[model samples]
Target: MLHKTELEYDANNHLFLDAYHDDAQPYLGLLIDIHGGGWFRGDKDKDADWATRLAQLGYEVLVPNYRLTPQVFYPEPLRDMDTLMTWIATSDFNQMPIGVVGSSAGGNMAVELAIRYGVPAVSLSGILDIDDWLTQHQAVEAAPGDLDRFNQQSSAAINQTGSNDAFYKWFVLNYFNQRTDELSAATPVHRISATTGPLFLANSLAEFVPTSGVLKLADALTSVQVPFVLNVLPGNRHAKGYLDDIFSQITAFLATYLIDQRPKPQLATE
Candidate 1:
């Protein structure tokens, strides 16, 4: 009963998004699932399965393709997200409650959008604090066999001597074009304010993305009094790797804010 439609969002850039939903059911809300590939690679199709699953749950899911690094730099991808939001606001689904879920780089953007629009969001292994992440990597020495293990598991080709943390740092630098000064502005942990919406953040205790950043963001959200849930799993899995195990919790969190909290129509007292 699931249906999917691909629609263009940015014609000039030839960017498009896939919409997934069940035609037989009323949409509970709109959930945007952003794909993640360290901000340098990845496409909307990467999240098709996740979108379909969400759609089956009675939510209209949107998976968008945004510009990546090398072709574009900091804020360009975020700008594309802005365009998508604008498009949604004018579309037929404008009035529906909105929530976002993303992995890694996409998770970072989800938090950004949540901060911008005050909508509920979930970030899975998001690189929340770029500056702190780089600093931490620089401060610590890689453990024995860490580099080899990372290279063995990574899909992207990495030098034999490179650790997972180093590879992550390379991509982050690439996304920012090495403008270290600008990293703070793009760091979601630093951007949190009182207006930021509820967020469910998850990260593995020993994942390549590092748990330190997630903890920092959690502390920052606390300081601002923004409601959030931090789930730190046990393993080296990053982002989508541990998603299946925690998916139910993710959906429950979304439903709490987007569906359960929504105002219900009053019944007539005839």
Candidate 2:
């Protein structure tokens, strides 16, 4: 069964959450699905398909939307997420094994949630470092009106092999609220430490968010000996395209922590 309702995760943010659960199968866990529109666009409906699929896999899927950028800013969205989780803790979903599946910007939030709260998470073609992303785009002479195209060229950058797609660049720029210096804090790669939780990150070689950021995250996790899996696929697709073939693999990984609640794999020191 699926239902639509408004849940106020924060006093200032009321999320439109589309929830799905299968009655035939016992509920395994709560999986929050976040959509990717680069923090400025997107809504619950965008991720409804993925959410319902996860629900069919026996987990309750909740796809929620938060405040967007230029209007709300970076930390505001993160704060809204914090409120969402806090509300969940006090509601019917309290303490149930929780996980997150996010695409792009949503992936960034999901990873932050996992790092902050110690929950398991998976990111599909997410941007790990916005600063690095901006730098890459600038190197290609991309600007505010470039759309998904790298330069002022008529062709979309995403259509070209090895080129990146960053349609949300303007949104991200506004998310910083004109204070670009704050981006360092918003960049997940910079924040990742030894305490970060189990993560499954998959990226397509031909997409926007550079594979370099993913590699950097993997390296940091490895340095701390954190248990994680980084999958770099050979393709020129973005978020949803990268997800089509990896659905089963992701569900299995979610099952490891959400259903089985496996003990955290110890690092060499731990």
Candidate 3:
């Protein structure tokens, strides 16, 4: 019943996206699932199973591969996402309601897109406040036995130095080209407005990503009176690491905004 097809969104760059849907039934809405790899490495295929599961629930899902850092920097990947959104807007599915869900770095972009496009979004362990995080946390090496605990609880691969802070900061610097001045501008917490769409944010209590950024984002969303839900589970698992436990709730939140509240298409009378 589920079908998947790959379509090119950026022909010039040879980038393609995988689309998933059920051929037997009308889809409820469009959902974009963005994969996370600290911005330098990751493929859409990594999220294929997750997209298939959402498609089985009556949603059309798209997973796109974006340009990564080193070869590209901060806004290039974001531009790739913008291009995908533009392609969708001009396609046959333009009339369908849409939403977005992402993990880690992808989650950061999802929140930005939700604000940019006014669509519901879900973020799993997103790095929401880069500027604040950089200021508050240092790239310290793991203490005695800390590496073992991090390895036990997290899905992230430890960098060569065995330091969580150093590993995370490395990716951030790569994405930004080591420029710290503009981080606040790219930070989602600093960009929230009254027009921003509803958001569902989930994070581990003490993951490689500091929980402080998530809380700061929540506070900003509250200050703007935007609707949002925050779920902090107990562990160090990041992003999709704990996704299975909260997936049903994520879909339900998306359904409330994208499907339940939208007007169903009516069949024409003969």
Candidate 4:
């Protein structure tokens, strides 16, 4: 919690982000931290610890916030996340070798960025496949007519154990608006390809998202021959910590992929 620093940003929706970096180095790579809060109710505070730790590990970190539901929905947040990524990339904000890390809602975005931008990333207990997630919610009443009915149904879903039902319900309704037709555009697994970057995925088999989803993502990555690893923790599906026990391996993985990745010079051409 010490040696913390924050940066100011205005996303034009009254949304802002707190940025931090390894000030010890004049120039450094970047790790963008996205906090998980059911996509509708979380902020950078959720991942500040992660940002701080990544900074200690010698990477500049950017933890951002996105405009959410009621005013906007699914694709909007995706665009917001992309805007931050693009800003960093073009600005070259003082470094190179950019990467992403997210948990829960944020985890989904991190994986999406990895797919979209082709950069190394990690997702902890992420809701990567949303259509599948809704199918598994068990409590969500599909397309509950109007917003009032939708809210009522989701209110019940909010109580489903380990489901994190409220967030799931809101994310869907806010985006698709009462339509259960399909979520192809929002699902990350369907978009994975050989060009996707290396990934480190971890999940706890408890509440919130399904462990099976994590395995499915891992399976897809393996099938494509993309370099990636999956770590399954005991039983805590909704767990997230960048400075906890599991982070040790995460650190090692990213250190190799993000920090150490640089072009090697060919033997001196005489």
Candidate 5:
């Protein structure tokens, strides 16, 4: 069974949740699905197909709609996500451990949330570094408004005092929240502590954003002694088979971590 409901967020942000059930036994607490649109466009509706599949597996899923770029910049989405998670924690569906799933831009944000909140997360070809992305976008030499309508926050930060790397003067600012250190802090690898939960990150070697981002995150996780799993499929799309693989692992992971369906003690031999 699947049900849809609206969730409230800071400043009248209306997020939606798609509830799923199968066999009645709770296999998960709550699942959050974030849509990717380069931080500029995209909606929860696009994630419906994936959410629906997860719901059929008996997990409650929330697909949040956030204010896109040109209207709001970095940190806003993070705040929006925080508000949604807090609401879920206090809501009736707050029974099971929360597992967040994200792809592309959303994947990047998902890693940040999991790290910041100490929740389990699965990132599909997540974009970990905004600086790197902007470099690829060629926003540095391009005219303003090429990347974002707002002031180039990232570019300005990197070259505040007019340091070299002329191209660095036009970095992607919306995602980094105008803070370089925040990038380091928000990164899943940086957030990894002994308390950090398990993570499953998959990327395609052919995809620059997801592939390089996953590599960076994996390296950081190694340095911090955090438990994480990385899967790189050569010649694959960013979100290729994402719904299938993510849902499968999430189901089993939830069963192992949340349900605790241990066997009952057997009666003494008669």
Candidate 6:
């Protein structure tokens, strides 16, 4: 009952849209799936099953492969997703409400996308602030093994083009751009505004990404009165096995929030 297809992309290499629709009728809605492998590894195929389930629910789906770490960094991922959303607004998918679902780093990107572009987002334990890990401050220290994984997988490593210290400087410079103001720019906490769109957050109580990040995000949304939902699932391991109950809750949330909003009109402009 679902049809699959690819989305042609532009020269910037910002977007790739893989879609699914019903065989007998047109697509009723769309969800963009952003995979999370700590911003370094993850692809559309890895998320196809999630997309497929949404498609089965009568919503079209797009799983885009964006520039990854060790190749691109920071704003590149956010920019890629933003451009893709703009492109989607002009495709056949135009005229339907758009929703995005991201995990881990992708979850961070999802919240950032909604903050910067006004797209509705559903994040499953996403990294909301890069500074929570990058800035070598006296924050909650990561365990030794976890720190090793962080070093290898953090988006900052994408720009490691020189010696260790130099690469770190490049990562920090590229991220903060030599200005203190830019620090906030790179942090989703700094981007929150009253106009920010809806966010549905799901966090594993056991995940070390910090419950505080989710709490901070939820507080901001609440302060600004942006429509949002937060689900803290206790005892679940860090983004562990596909919990069907969580998935069902996510699908229901998307259906309720996205079912009626209209997509952009796709009339070609000469």
Tell how far residue 38 is off in model 6, in angstroms: 1.2
Tens-digit lDDT string for candidate 1 (1-270): 888999998888899999999988888899999888778777888788778889999999999999998899998999999999999999987989999999888899999999999989999888787877776667554332233322122222322222366567777888888778887788887778998889999987766677777798789989999888999987677777777888999988998989744769999998
Q: Residue 86 CA error for candidate 4 (Å)?
A: 1.8
Of the candidates shown, which would achieve the greatest lDDT relative to the real structure? 1
103-161 in candidate 3: lDDT tens per residue? Answer: 88889989989989888999988878688777776655323223332322233432322
Cα error, residue 244 of model 1, in Å, equals 1.6
- C-alpha displacement of 121 in model 6, angstroms? 0.9
Better of 2 and 3 by lDDT: 3
Worst 10 residues of 5 by lDDT: 150-159
Error of 5 at 91 (Å): 0.9
Estimated TM-score for each candidate: 0.88, 0.85, 0.88, 0.81, 0.73, 0.77
Q: State how far residue 168 of model 6 sits from its true place (Å).
A: 15
Best first by lDDT, ranked: 1, 3, 2, 4, 6, 5
Off by over 4 Å in 2: 1-6, 133-140, 144-162, 165-171, 260-270
Give one digit per residue, the lDDT tens place, for model 2 in 1-270. 554455555565546577778877778899888877767666777786787788777887878878887568878888878878888889898857899988877888889888898788999877676787776666443334333432221112333355434434655676677577877777887777777878999888876666877888898888887778888988666666667678878988898877646346688974
- Residue 105 lDDT, candidate 3, scale 0-100: 86
lDDT-best of 1 and 5: 1
lDDT of 5 by residue, 1-270 (tens): 456665555446654544445545455556788866557656777677777777777777888887777777777878888888777777786766677778767787778776877677777767675555444655345222333421221111211222222222222454554556555445455556666556678876554343566787778777777667787765544453434545566566655544432335699997
| Off by more than 4 A, model 5 | 14-27, 132-188, 240-242, 245-247, 257-270
What is candidate 6's local distance difference test score? 0.67
